[model samples]
Each structure stands twice: as C-alpha cells, then as structure tokens.
Target: MKRPLLFLVACMIAQLSFAQSKDEKAVAAAVENMRKAMIDGERTALENLADSRLTYGHSSGLIEDKPTFVEHIASGGSDFVSIDLLDQTITVAGNTAIVRHVLHAATNDNGKPGKVALKILLVWLKEGGEWKLLARQAVKEPAK
Candidate 1:
C-alpha cells in the first residue's frame, strides 16, 4: 500500500509541474493556429487571428497594420514554407498575454527560397472569448 501511494503522489507532482493555466494554454493554442495559418496562407484564418488594430513590425524595420499584414501573408507575398517555434514562453496577465519565442523558418518570398531565424515577441488580447494578436515584433537573431 505504501509503495503504490508514493508512486501515485510522485506522478501527481510531475503532472502538476507540466500543467498550464487555462489562459496560458489558450494563448499557446492561438499562437500555433497563427503559425499554421501563416504557413498555409489561409486568408480567413489570418484575418480572424489578427485584432482590428494590430501593429506588426518586422526585423527589417518594416511596419504594417492589420489589413496590410493579413493581405501580404494571405496573398503569399510573405510566404513561409515552414515555421519552427523554439524556446517559447507565455505569460498571461488578465486578458493579455505576452509570448516570446525563437522562430526559425524556411521561406519562399516572391519565388526566392531563403531561411531566417528571428526572436519574436507577440502580444495577444482575449476578445469575444477568443485570443487575437494585438501586436507582434521580430528581430533577427544575433550570430553565435
């Protein structure tokens, strides 16, 4: 009996350490959905994911509003062949979430294939029971 009880408690502790809060999980899911939409050039999904007043900034110092951002991605002007998000961390405070990650991507922009590595910061807001991207900024990763 003691051995089984100790094993159960240990498993419970492990599970607790891996568990995320409801909001945190939601934000993570939202981030994943956005990534998929970007790769697939899903116009509707990209539009829905972005807040009405989104401010998107690129590592090149280009800034775009919601309409421009969605249009560029959906039209395949900003095409992503694949995206990998690494070392991601999410923090939720009230209805806002701040997400940081290292993004490595294979891209084919206007028919030229390329690769990029960037550090990304995203701000999400919970609106109408859904997480929407309010802002995002990216910076090129420094040489190792």
Candidate 2:
C-alpha cells in the first residue's frame, strides 16, 4: 500500500511539472510563430505579431522601433536562416508575459552568412485577445 501511494504521488507530480497554463501555451505558440516568420522574412506576419510600440534591441547595441525592426527583418538587412530557441521560460502577469530563452541561429545579414548565439528576453502583451510582441532585448550568450 505504501509503495502504491508513493508511485501515485510521483505520477501526479510528474504530470503537474509537464502541464502548461493556458497563457503559457499561447505565449509558446506565439514564440514559435515569430521564429518561423523571422526565418521566412514574412513582412506581414512580422508586422502583425509586433505591437505598435515595439522596442527591439540587438546584441550589437542597436535599438529599433516597431517599423525599423520589421523593415530590417523583412528586407533581409538582418536575416535569419534558421533559429533554435533553447531552455525557454515564460511567465505571465496580468496582460503581460515575460519570456527568456537562449537563441542560436544561422544568419545571412546583408548577403554574408554567419551564426549568432544570444540570450533573449521578450515581452508580450495581450490586447483584444491577441498576443503581440511589445519588446525584445538580446545579449551575447554566456559561455557554457
């Protein structure tokens, strides 16, 4: 009986650990959509996902508003060939979500192939039942 009870408790805890909240699920989907859009350089998708007041920061210390960010990404000025987000965490508070992840990507910025590894922090806001990227900041990835 004791062994059965312990096993049941362990199963419950494991289920709880794997479960995601509703908002967390939405945020994760949005993050994946953005990743795909970035790699594809979809201007309309990028524009739709970003809030009107977006503030995007780069690891190279460049900061851009919504228009600039969208344009640069869409025009291939800052191109992403492939993006892999690792060890992501999402926290929701009221209408805002804060997400952090390690981003490793292949890029072709201005026709030159390169790779980038960054630690990314992203803020998303829910407006009219849709999640939009409000802010994002990226920094150099820490050595492992």
Candidate 3:
C-alpha cells in the first residue's frame, strides 16, 4: 500500500512539473514571437499581442500609446541590427503572468551603432484564452 501511494505521489509531482514547464515554454515562445514581429517591423503582429489597455514605458523616459508604439516600430526610423535576450524570468499566477528580462540590442542611429542594454518588465493577462500584454516597462542600463 505504501509503495503504491508513493508511486502515485511521484506521478502527480511529475505531471505538475510537466505542466509548469509547458506553461513556461508557451510564455517564452509568445514573447519571442513578439520580439521577432517588432524587429521585422510587423506592427500588426505586435498590435495583436497588446492589450487594449496597454501602458508602455520606454528606457528613454518616454511613454507611448499603443498605436504610437506600433507606428514607431513599423517605421524605418529606428533600425535594429539585433535584439538578443540575455536573461528572463517569468512568474505565472492563475490568469496573469509577469516577465522580467534583460536584453542586448544594437540599432542604427545617425549612421552610428547605437548599442543599448535594457531591463524590461512585461505584465500579461489571459483574455479569452489568449495572453495579451497589459503593461511593459523598459529601463536602459547606465553607460559603463
């Protein structure tokens, strides 16, 4: 009887772990897709991920409305060579998730390589079985 109980517990634990891992993967993939859309200047894709009540904050102490952000990314005004994820942490609680990330990015600005290190926090909420980003804040790392 004891052996059977222990085995059942082990199975439950394994199943829970697997579920959590799947959730994490889903979140990661969603964020990666968002990043790719932005880099590829796909405003429509980025817009789809954004919540209607989005609050976006940027490292330059600027805040942008959802439409403005989409327009900016889609425009050729800012060119990105690469945007790499350095590290990320995601915590899920029921229908909400918070993601914190560090990114290494390079862009084209005035014919110069505009290198930036950024820390970002994104809050997502599940709406109708889809995750939408409700808020996002990014802070630039101080020049070293």
Candidate 4:
C-alpha cells in the first residue's frame, strides 16, 4: 500500500512539472511573438497579442492603454532596428504568468537613432486557450 501511494505521488509530481514547463514555453512564445510584432510594426498582431485592459508602462514613466500602445507602434513613432532579449525567466501561476527579461535594442524614434537597454517585466494571462499580454513595465538599465 505504501509503495502504491509513493508511486502515485511521484507521478503527480512529474505531471505537475511537465504542465509548468508547457505553460512556460507557451508564455515565452507569446512574448517572442509580441517582440516580433513590435519589430515589424505589425499593429494587428500587436493588438491581438495584448489584452484590452493592457497597461504598458515605459521606462520614461509614461503609461499607455491598449489603444494608445497600438497606435504608437503603428504610427511609426518608434521603429526598432533590432531587439535582443537576455536573461529571460518565466514563472507560471495558474492562469497567469510573469516574465522578466533584459532587452537591448537599436531604435529610431522619429528619426533620432539610439540604443537602449532595459529590464522588462511582463504579465500575461491565459484566455481562450491563448496567452495575452495583460501588462508590461520597463525600467532603463543603468549604464555599464
């Protein structure tokens, strides 16, 4: 009887770990898709990936809602030349996932070229079997 119980516990642990891994992958994919959309200036894709209640906070302390965020990307206000993400970590909690990453990018905003490095925190929620960005906040990384 004790052996059977131990086997059941082990199986449960394995299943839980697998599920977490799967969720983490999905969350990571969602984040990557968003990044690609941002780089491509794909407004529709960006709109689709983000929840309607999204709150996007910029490194400069500016906050934007979903519509404003979409408009800003679509309007060519900021164009990304390249984006490199590093040290990404994703944590899944039920239907919610938190992602932390460092983003380094070359950008041309209104024709002013610059490079930026920031630490980003993204919150995603699973809805209708899809992960959508619910909120994102970024802070400028100190110069090294």
Local accuracy of candidate 3 as per-residue lDDT tens digits, 1-144 = 999999999999999876655556777777898788867878789899888888889888888878877777778555567889877888988888899998787887544678879999999888887888888999986677
Q: Could you tally the backbone clashes for each prediction?
A: 0, 0, 0, 0
* TM-score per model over all chains: 0.91, 0.92, 0.80, 0.86
Go through the candidates in order and give each one's C-alpha lDDT: 0.97, 0.96, 0.82, 0.93
In model 3, the runs with Cα more than 4 Å from the true position are: 1-19, 109-112, 142-144
Q: Tell me how far the alpha carbon of residue 77 in candidate 1 is from the true structure, in angstroms, after superposition.
A: 1.0
Instruction: After superposing candidate 1 on the true structure, give the runs of residues whose Cα lies further than 4 Å from its correct spot.
Output: 1-14
lDDT over C-alpha atoms for residue 120 of model 3: 95
- In model 4, which residue pairs have backbone atoms overlapping below 3 Å? none
lDDT by residue (tens digit), candidate 2, 1-144:
999999999999999988998999999999999999999999999999999999999999999999999899999999999999999999999899999999999999999999999999999999998999999999999788
The TM-score measured for candidate 1 stands at 0.91
Q: On lDDT, who's better, 3 or 4?
A: 4
Which pairs clash in model 3? none
Q: Which stretches of candidate 2 lie over 4 Å from their true place?
A: 1-10
In angstroms, the error of model 2 at 128 is: 0.9
Poorest stretch of ten by lDDT in candidate 2: 16-25
**Candidate 1 or 3, higher TM-score?**
1
